[model samples]
Target: MASEESLEESKKKVYRKEQALKRTAESLEDDEEIELPRKRYYRQRAHSNPFSDHELIYPAKPEDMKWSMLYGGSNEAPTVADVGCGFGGLLVSLSPALPKERILGIEIRVQVTQYVLDRIHALRKQNQGKEVDYTNIACLRGNAMKFLPNFFGKGQLKKVFFCFPDPHFKLRKHKARIISPTLLSEYAYCLRPGGIVYTITDVKDLHDWMRSHLEAHPLFERLSSEEEESDECVKIMTTATEEGKKVARNGGSKYIACFRRTENPK
Candidate 1:
């Protein structure tokens, strides 16, 4: 027969085990309430073609893009695109600046894209009766480098912004940079003649790389400092992006380069 102290110890062990099991069951039940599927957090490799990933968010073609869903019967396609629009500060600022123009923000991360979507929805609801409505702005999860032409027809856009894009610091990963000679041709295809492509970054090397590539590209012409300063959008591009604001807080220098899509060679 066990002593009274031993019996008490056994009872305490059983009680603690029971409590632990109960807590686990309750935790599982709580998890069941979250029905949304988990999104994949990483891509194994950069997509060479946009259409290869059937599950990635995208319209089949420019006509099927459904712009009216965002702008409510506005037939005009989005004239501005904020590529790699992390946290969507630039898009929000531009929405009010160009109330009549439709703008799209392209982000690859699912959670970040969803956050921007929610932010835009909230802004629209909040400003329903206000003079400045936010229905002109929208966010899409996409690989802009691959699928840009899929969403916009040839020469559909007037302005394309690459605000503080990923530097891809490694020499081997440089192709992943948003600005490249090959990508510039695609950008030129989507931008109307004389359309502006605005690029800003705190990384001086990346800035020089982008400027050099755009300068060498046959379809792009570098914008003069006077021309860059004259445009209202340039000011917003510098101060309105989340990355830009962060750089400002850290006292980092910002480099800006703008290019115009020249008309096709005669």
Candidate 2:
């Protein structure tokens, strides 16, 4: 029963965090320009170590999630997920671009997640009653590597973005990289056949590593150059991520590799 008690305590902590988040969003005034969250105030280490949970909240399963608290009006489950969504650049960019689809940004850092939450609330209030009010986009605090399948049902997501992910340079730490053989299976299971997986990174070694793994996965097929160029999501991702912007400012190279989730083998 100790294990069960621990689970209950974790759930309570998560519930309290949710309530605090609600209060923060509710406290925002419907002003001409809702005050934007300051990055300096939401200070967090550049690289997050996912093993550190810090007592955050997540659903036991997808069904138990309270998505309405994360979004304003949308009742639909998120169709797109941006993993390691630092500062939520892609999440904000994709909001108006795909107003019909619910986009969820999953980040592990508590302060970063709070900043994204505040930023989203500000954006919604700023664009209130506009054509695209950003009700379809939201951010959540969770470890995507460990809990993605718990939050996304089978064949639930149509698009998944891994933009400028941590390279995990040390050979011993390669297993910590997000696109490992085992994680790819979970990704494939969550995405429907023909769904797209978009990955980009400035680090060449990490690029090659992710590409090789996805290629080896039986359920994934690499997209063609023409297809990558033509995809709107790919285009947005190239410039929408915070790390992508930093790379551009420093004149670094970015490698992109996209794959299609194919049907499960008979």
Native-to-model Cα distance after best TM-score fit, residue 122 in candidate 1, in Å? 0.5
For each candidate, give its TM-score against the true structure: 0.79, 0.88
lDDT of 2 by residue, 1-266 (tens): 99997877686557546545655666673344556766755666888886665576778888887777777554568999999999999999998788879999998888789889888877877787899888888888888888898899999999999998888899988989999999999999999999999999999999999999999999999999999999999999999988999999999999999999999889
Q: Which stretches of candidate 1 lie over 4 Å from their true place?
A: 1-54
Instruction: Go through the candidates in order and give each one's C-alpha lDDT.
Output: 0.80, 0.87
Write the residue-wise lDDT of candidate 1 on 47-101 in tens digits: 2333346368678889888777766766668989999887789999999899888
Off by over 4 Å in 2: 1-32
Best by TM-score: 2
Residue 261 C-alpha lDDT in model 1: 93
Error of 2 at 82 (Å): 0.3
